[model samples]
Target: MTTITLGRYLWERVYQIGVRTIFGVPGDFNLQPLDYIYHVDNLRWVGNQNELNAAYAADGYARIKGVPGVLVTTHGVGELSALNGVAGALSE
Candidate 1:
């Protein structure tokens, strides 16, 4: 077993789960995780115009790739803006 920070573990899981790209609007709460994810090879972080659009982009990518596309939005409003797409993906 390898010991690593929670952020690293989370990002690593995303990589292992076959996420080659991520989409989101960066913000304070999620910045750390995003920074960590940046160091991962073959993982491209695609910043979107807004959380809602970010969610849509991620959902679309996931649909085509068959992998859970990553979306890193901040807490509160940013996260809320992304909820609809997330819920939609969950339903499907």
Candidate 2:
């Protein structure tokens, strides 16, 4: 029997969809999931200066890669900070 954490399962799905890199800013709420990134082969984590920057980076990556890019952010304040970038991606 093999057991995989939710973080690993989600990351596997992201990888299956051709996402080679993930962008985000580390935070107290997200530290646990970030740990799973270290164990996934061929998956790279790019830590940005802030949530907004991470969102922008992910959007740019998706544009260049032709596959959806993934971004991880903490709840509340983190999410709020990334909204402008997310909105930009959506409007584009």
Candidate 3:
């Protein structure tokens, strides 16, 4: 059996979906998990100042690139802050 970290698995899935650019804000809980970016080919992470902005950027990227947008954020308040932007992305 083959074993892989969730971070690596997540990135591999994202890469499979044609996500070359990721937009998000790294938080305490997500920092380590996001390190899997380095192991993927042509996958680059774009750090934002906050979750809200990250969500918006991801939404924008998804629209422009015609692929899924990946967003990373911490728990609680950080997740909540991105609600509006994510909702917008879903609506459009």
**1-92: candidate 1 lDDT, tens digit per residue:** 96788877777788898988989998877888888876777888899989889999999999999998788888877778799878887897
Superposed by TM-score, candidate 2 places the C-alpha of residue 50 at a distance from the truth, in angstroms, of 0.8
Over 1-92, each residue of candidate 2 has an lDDT whose tens digit, in order, gives 99999999988888999999999988888899998887789999999999999999999999999999799988778798899899999998
Task: Name the lDDT value of residue 88 in candidate 3.
Answer: 82
List candidate 1 segments past 4 Å from native.
90-92
Model 2 lDDT, full chain set: 0.91
lDDT for residue 81 in candidate 3, whole number 0-100: 83
TM-score of 1: 0.85
Local accuracy by lDDT, each model: 0.86, 0.91, 0.88
Better of 2 and 3 by TM-score: 2
Collision pairs in model 3:
none
Query: Candidate 3 — what's its lDDT?
Result: 0.88
Candidate 2 has its poorest 10 consecutive residues by lDDT at 69-78
Write model 3 residue lDDT over 1-92, tens digit each, in one string: 99998989999999999999888887778889889998888999999998899999999898899998888887878788899889988896
